[model samples]
Target: MPSLTDSHTFSLPSSCSFLISVTDTNPISLAALRSTHFYLLGEGSNSIFVDDFEGVVVQNKIKGLESDDLNDVIMLRVGAGENWHDLITTCLKNHWYGMENLALIPGSVGAAPIQNIGAYGLEVSTFIESVEFIELETGAKHKIKSNECRFGYRDSIFKNDLAGKVLITHVNFVLPKSNYMETSYGELANLNAPTPEKIFNTVIGIRRKKLPDPRQWGNAGSFFKNPIIDKSLLTQIQHEYPDIPFFCISKTLVKVPAAWLIDKLGFKGKVLGGVQCHPHQPLVLVNIGSATGKDVLEFARLIMSRVKEKFNIELEPEVRLIGRNGLIEL
Candidate 1:
């Protein structure tokens, strides 16, 4: 078995029957995929292997970057395997703009669209022109336009109907020359006369202060998504705790911070076995040392249960958890 302990950001002890790294899409073939169970992996920043996988683990490393500068918009075709933050830095250096607000986000470009990765007030989906992928079963290539992606808050078609069925090879992004700076989220909102460079630096600084370095402390960034609930529920919670922080998504929907709810329950720095809710950010679950898959599941369940009991809201995991066979629900 091939060890997967270092493959994922969570750094859990695990293994797989076979491991394959795909660097070029042309020569690759998945003829045997019909008979064998397989899992696609990128930089593994947003996934955790809880137990030994009973199948093959395909690591996507196809790499390339091409840019076409038009009069009004710059088109970027990025390889799925490219480091996301590095791409952002490259774009900034080239004065491509727009992606500055997403600086310091972990994982590969391929994984970005799947999660509809966003930060501050910008989402990757906003610049996405299209996605190119190869179907795992037939090895056929296909491209889906941005409008067909069904991008939502922390979601996309790749996470739904297409998950595990195709391998994303590249992402096309279109950035308008007249891009405006966004600083509406959290600490970024306080920036005085923000530029793309300023926003980039501030986003990096903010993430570093809030999120633990994955290499030093094993973590999958945010453990749970910020739950978006009905406005009626928000009003009910506000009655008990007046300062309950929330973002109005619409007239009927509200987005509540998961960290606040967990912190209110005193889960920050809370440890069970070897798994601990991050002290600085309660929404992140970290592997203190020698943490097992079961330990992570147990710790996450505890947080979810507490939040549900108090807030009457269900917390869904932001990170993907793999069991012995494949993906498992909390």
Candidate 2:
């Protein structure tokens, strides 16, 4: 379910299909695993397993959704494996605010912080109070605050040194109880309504119409993180390509749209073998029919190289690469 690209003919490892619990997820028994090395961040939206490796793939089937409503805020605690969108829709159905800007992000709540999944004009970290994860080495559970997670533009500690070392079991977020929405990015700027529900539906509707349904096609959403550049480089690019869209990330860092750069470089909808850039959203890569992990990674590297050569901005992938080292070439 990773959103990188579609793949029906992938040569994946048999471990990917193994499940300790598929019918009712109660954390799989340690005895059942028999000392199998495994790692998990999020499922379905932000990452890919690459190949079917020797390690076991333990699906976090933990499930629950609850909210404590107060005057202007609602604190939500959700299971790690619960479908993120389903939980979002439930929150909206209960008239919860805050998360409206984050509608349609894929994967489990446990996996959200690894990359601080964001869309439209907001990222999940905006509301995250804390993240709960199980330490694999200690066999203990711990909670870390939002700031402690070291959240950045599409990054967090979970995806770095802490990656593959813990199993995220739960996540807590404090959302608004009243109208709260921020429409500052791209298409969202066109929104005029002030209601939180309007903002939520607008984002959800847009994503539903724009991104392909994972059930129908394989993909990991946007493959590459929008490049962050310095002010001088931004000014230089602005002069050369007036239409290049960018936003100031900090006094020293400005975020540039990698998709725009890729499309402008004439890579949009281009296909090679079994992989191709998404036609509708050039930022995404598609498996087309039966693509391999290597095919997609090689194509992605080409785009990254081109972006670096042309703009001097080093592009980084947001998707987590699982399995072996040679799975993809940088």
Instruction: Tell me the tens digit of each residue's lDDT in model 2 across 1-330.
Output: 233222221222213434343223234454344356654434646556576544555567777777787777888888887878787888878877777777777777777777788887788899899988777666667899998999988889987778767777778989866545687776778877667777777887888887777665667788888988888988898798887888887879878888898998899889976777878788888666677766766788899899889888888887756654312335
What stretches of model 1 exceed 4 Å from their correct place? Answer: none
| lDDT score of residue 218 within candidate 2 | 68
lDDT of candidate 1 over 1-330, digit per residue (tens): 999999999999999999988887863456666568999999999999999999999899989999999999999999999999999999999999999988999999999999999988788999999999998778899999999999999999999999998899999999999997888888888999889999999999899999999899999999999999999999999899889999988989999999999999999998999898898999899998879999999999988998999989899999999988899999
Question: What is the alpha-carbon lDDT of model 2 when measured against the actual structure?
Answer: 0.71
> Judged by lDDT, which candidate is best?
1
The candidate 1 region of ten consecutive residues with least summed lDDT is 26-35
lDDT (0 to 1) per candidate: 0.93, 0.71
For each candidate, what TM-score against the reference? Answer: 0.98, 0.88
Per-residue lDDT of 197 in model 2: 75
Record all residue pairs in model 2 with backbone atoms less than 3 Å apart, i.e. clashing: 3-219, 3-220, 3-221, 4-219, 4-220, 5-218, 6-287, 12-52, 13-52
Clashes of each: 0, 9
